[model samples]
Target: MIQVAFYDIAEESLFDFAVIIAIKEGKWILCRHKDRRTWEFPGGHRDPGEWIEDTARRELYEETGAEHYTLQPVCAYSYLRQGEKASFGMLYYAQVDELGPLPAFEIEEVKLYDKFPEKKDFWTYPDIQPFLLRKVSGLGIK
Candidate 1:
């Protein structure tokens, strides 16, 4: 399990995190773990002393069997969750040259969609939708 810590301080510490918005064959790739069963980008918490870009690269490889991609920072934002003041997120647009066979481990399924899914029950982070829309609209990353 991922562990988060809190401390009383004059300034807030952002919980550094990164995600890979991988696109392949004119489609976007998303995944869902059997435990969470929520659709999310391939990513995870950043390791201590790890560069943000490195975190994104490593998480993408670990979560999905994807390689040969490029990272472009799209957006950054902060929000509150579960009554905790947490801050952090870096969404990177990843263009992959190849889509390899993904192994089923923590991820139950890897789905590629031409258009974003319209399921209301799907687990998607709030900020991600807007970020994606902005990218698609050619407004550039915020």
Candidate 2:
């Protein structure tokens, strides 16, 4: 599992983070490493010189070999880790015209599921699933 930690303490909270749900042809794209077969959305820590949207695009392309996609911010949420509070994530919805081929770096394999798979097959950040399901089902954000 990827565990995020906060090393710096600030008076106020930090609220800048990003995640992307890359959707292609009505299916969502997820990636996993060889050792850990559980699938998750393609995302990571934002780089020093990149914007959140750029980070989402870069991660999506780097992990799934996907290009030319549209991204829209969906929602934001906070979570606590190791007794410290932090702005956990800002989730985005990405619509891709084509999925292309899988990129060799970072990602081992790409799995596209039509609907949210059984939770047993993978673990995801808490806020991701509901928004994704809503988007997939055309129900809008719940």
Candidate 3:
């Protein structure tokens, strides 16, 4: 089973990885990975020497074709499993300003949702997505 805990952190934190919980005009942004038929936020492992927020930004643009937007750190989370080393990732909230055409690279397609989509992968729909949505709403987003 996957387990995670979240803690608020500075945007400039040195966390090595992250995922963006991006929204534009009141809709959440989700991506379909080329390798999996699953939808997830635009985020991943960070490049060496990259700041936590930059990782969120890079991943957002790379996955969603989001050029202009307001990105903020919601918190950092730790993923823990019974027999594995704990890993850290930052959760970011972005109000996308401009979204260019999605690049046909790692991500196959991008979708915007008013409410969380029910038909999604377990790790995303029930796990990652709801957690991110609560984090965003808890911060005052409707």
Candidate 4:
């Protein structure tokens, strides 16, 4: 089984990745990776010595061409699968105001959604992404 848990922002240093659940013009933004047909939030691993917030911004621009946005740290989350060590990431919520051309990256394309799509098989990280989305939604993110 895959287990997920939330952490206080005070645990920031434990985070290894940064994921952005972003919105543009009232719609959610989702990205498709070049190697997979599944959709996912714009996010990525932190670079050596880089700030977690910078990881969020860099990944957002590289994946979705999100040029202008207001980003806020939503929470920290960790996920663990049976027989595997837990992985940690910080979650961010962004209200995007502008976009530029997508940089050549692992992400193949980005789509805007009126709501997170209901198709279960469409997600790249079904075990974790949807749960995170739901948590953020309950906090009144739109």
Candidate 5:
């Protein structure tokens, strides 16, 4: 089983990835990778010496074309696989004010949803994503 933990302090060097849960006009923004059918939030690994928050912004723009937006850090989180060391990441909430054409990046498509779909088949990382979604929802995002 994978285990997830939340920490109050976001130690910059410890975080390896950044993910943004974006909202545009009350709807959720999601992305589909060019190589995968499942949907996921815009996120990626941190570039060397890049601030974690910048990682979220860069990935969000690269994957979703969100040119204008306000981003807020939600929390710092870590997940541990059964045999691997814990991997740390920072989660963010983005209120997108504008979007341009999708960039020709790794993502194939960007979409909006009134609410997260109930079907588990829609997610790229089923087990992990649901937990992340629930954490965001707990913030009263809706």
Candidate 6:
């Protein structure tokens, strides 16, 4: 099982890696990797010299083509990779307005859903969404 850590954006005590659980209006944003067929949240590694919050903003825009949005750090999370290795990322929630053309990159497509999709197993990191939802619910998404 993936373990979760929740924190306020102000606390700012997570690793450089980040993932954003973006919500536009009332829907959630998900992306399909160009190389990998599976879908996942809009986020990526915090590049050298980039802040975690900036990483979240950049990744969200790059992946989803979200033009105008409000992004906020909801939590910092860690999970067991390959059932043993520990991996961590910052979790963010976004309220997006306008979406523009997608930038040519690792992302192939972007999608929105009112709730978790039916074929949830197709999600890139199976534990990510549920864990994020549970943690955000536990902490409350602001």
Question: lDDT values of the candidates?
Answer: 0.66, 0.64, 0.79, 0.91, 0.92, 0.77
Candidate closer to the true structure by lDDT (higher is better), 2 or 5: 5
The TM-score of candidate 6 is: 0.83
Candidate 3 lDDT by residue in tens digits, 67-120? 999987778887777799877888888899899999767999899888764565
Which window of ten consecutive residues has the lowest lDDT sum in model 4?
6-15
Give the per-residue lDDT of model 2 (tens digit) for 47-111: 77666667777888887888778887665544555555455655677887777777777678888
Clashing pairs in 6: none
Write one digit per residue (lDDT tens) for candidate 6, span 13-118: 4465788877776777889998887888888887887788888888888999999988777767776655676666788788889889999988999988777756
The digit string of per-residue lDDT tens for model 4 on 37-57 reads 999999999999888999999
Show where candidate 2 strays beyond 4 Å: 1-16, 119-121, 124-142
- Ranking according to lDDT, highest score first: 5, 4, 3, 6, 1, 2
lDDT of 2 at 18: 57
Candidate with best TM-score: 5
Q: Which residue pairs come into collision in candidate 5?
A: none
RMSD of 6: 2.8
lDDT of 2 at 140: 49
What ranges in model 1 sit over 4 Å off? Answer: 1-15, 103-105, 126-142
Give the per-residue lDDT digits (tens) of candidate 5, residues 1-142: 8898888786789999998999999999999999999999999999999999899999999999999999999999999999999999999999999999999989999999997777868999886887888899999996
TM-score of 3: 0.87
Question: What lDDT is reached at residue 92 by model 6?
Answer: 78
Which candidate ranks first by lDDT, i.e. highest? 5
Q: How many clashes in each structure?
A: 0, 0, 0, 0, 0, 0
Off by over 4 Å in 5: none
Error of 6 at 58 (Å): 0.8
